[model samples]
Target: MSMRVAVVTGAARGIGLAVAQRLASVGMKVVMADLRDAAQAASMVNRDLCAGVDADVSDEASVQQLVAGVVARYGRLDVLVNNAGISPKHGGRKARVEDTALPEWQSVLDINLTGTFLMCRAALPHMRAAGWGRIVNLSSQAGRSRSAVTGAHYAASKAGILGFSRILAEEVGGDGITVNCVAPGRIATAMAAAVPETVNQEIAARIPLARLGTAAEVADAVSFLVSEQAAYLTGVTLDVNGGYFMA
Candidate 1:
């Protein structure tokens, strides 16, 4: 088969960038979309199959442009990775839900949950036409339960992704498209580092692996689902938590 074309949201940095880079490494053409400029990220990562486009996953029109831009260049969409998400301004950033602003809560839902929906909805037509597609949503351990470090909105949005993926998986399975989610545990990143050293140590100590996960590790899980290996694995939430929370 020819190299697959994929759109990875929030690909400017951190986990999103890692996922985009991983896919590109595997002969996939990746369109790196982010709320911020992706030029720097594109320059830093593998360039052969990677391109950057500024996009706000939270906006309907922006998402439309994103899909159109990719299909315009790549001709088809083989994968959609919904990795663009925001920590609730008040909560996930070390504040409690009660302390969070209304905008923060709504923004979290808009990007984390609604953003995923928009991307999937916009990409569905293209996938149905091709009769093959892979939709991977970036969920988190918070989705499974309230994380000590995450706010209510962040947890709620991630959890919403799980339910959304399951329903969409069933809706599109017959069309040769698979929908799934990957919930990552604490990874060695700026966001994860926000937790105090004490907190980090405590969480890591509790994990069977006794360490935090790497972005590449999360990428590996996503890579599998988008590959032929996971054709039958739809509507599943693969935990890349490294024994942090096993369910």
Candidate 2:
């Protein structure tokens, strides 16, 4: 069989980088896509097993170009890891809803929610053509409940992803494609750095694990979800929160 082609957005660093590395390590030809140029980050991994693309997931035209470039080179897409997102901070904590600006809210929604939809739309047709595909959307613990570390817009975007994944899973299961969401808690990454140190410490202390989860742990879950081992699972939210929240 030919090697699988996996596309992971926001893959220059953090959870996105970790997921790209994990998938590549497993023999998939991984494509690392990010708003920033990813040539350097992609070089850190096996250059032969990985490639990079500059993409702004929030823009429809950019997203289309991203998928087209990947298909033009690899001819097929088997897995999509939608990890591009932002959690904005003001004064080292989430901006209160009343204080949140309209632009901030829209930017978060554009990248976190609409971006996922666009990437899925662009990649799903290829997967359906091949008769198999895996889509893992990065959600958050905030989406499941309330979060002290992120803004309302961040939480709302993630919650929107949950709903979108479920509906898409229902629509595409017959085509041999699976859509799922990975809701991570306070994973130690640049994105999580937006939270105040005190807030992170306090939240960590409350968790049974008593520490922040690492990006690699979340990546491991994502790897499984996209692997053949998880072929039967769809429309489920996998929590990688280290006991911070349970459902």
Candidate 3:
């Protein structure tokens, strides 16, 4: 059998890189996709299983080409980890709704929410044709509640992702595809660096784990959802927040 092909967006660094590395290590043909820096990531990952693409997930044209190029090269796509996202600009968080600019809010939703939507829509044709697929979205704890530091737009986008994943799962379960999400909390990444250190440290002290979550930890959760072991699971949001929020 041919190796399974997987694409993970925003995989140039941090959680995205960790997930891409893990998937590649497991013998999957991992395409590490990102817009900010693609050549750097392609050069860094293991040569055998990882490849990189400078893809802007927010743009439909870019996403179309991204999926097509990957499929053209590998012949199939089995797993998709939508890890590309932003805080305020991409809806991970936003300032006060009234104060936030419409363009900024739209930009956030475009990248964080619309980006995921487009990837899923584009990948579905191939997945449905093959009769098997795995989609793992990177949501956030803020989606469940309010962000301690992130903006409202970020929270709203993530919340939207949760509902979208559930519905997609229900729609495709009969076709041998699973749609799931991972909601991370306080992971130590450049994205999280936006907040002040003093605030970050204070927030870290509140988690039951009493420490920041690692990118690798979140990757593990994502890997699980996309693997055959999770065959029976779908439409669920697995929280990887170090007990920041229960239930």
- Highest-scoring model, TM-score: 2
Total backbone collisions, model 1: 0
| Candidate No. with top lDDT | 2
Native-to-model Cα distance after best TM-score fit, residue 8 in candidate 1, in Å: 0.5
lDDT of 3 by residue, 20-71 (tens): 9889878898988998676578678887788888999899999999999999
Q: What's the TM-score of every candidate structure?
A: 0.96, 0.98, 0.96
lDDT of 2 at 131: 94
User: How much does candidate 1 score in TM-score?
Assistant: 0.96
- Summarize candidate 1's per-residue lDDT along 15-90 as a digit string, tens digits: 9999988998888988899977786787778767888899998899999999998999889999999999877332
- Lowest summed-lDDT stretch of 10 residues in model 2? 191-200
Worst-scoring 10-residue span by lDDT in model 3: 88-97
Model 2 clash pairs? none
Candidate 1 residue pairs that clash: none
Write out the backbone clash pairs for model 3.
Answer: 87-92, 87-93, 91-154, 92-154, 93-151, 93-154, 94-151, 94-152
Query: Across residues 3-117, which tens digit of lDDT does each residue of candidate 2 receive?
Result: 9999999999999999999999999999999988687889998699999888999999999999999999999999999999998887777899999999999999999999999
- lDDT for every model? 0.89, 0.94, 0.89
Can you give the lDDT of residue 77 in candidate 2?
Answer: 94
Q: How far is candidate 1 from the true structure (C-alpha RMSD, Å)?
A: 1.5
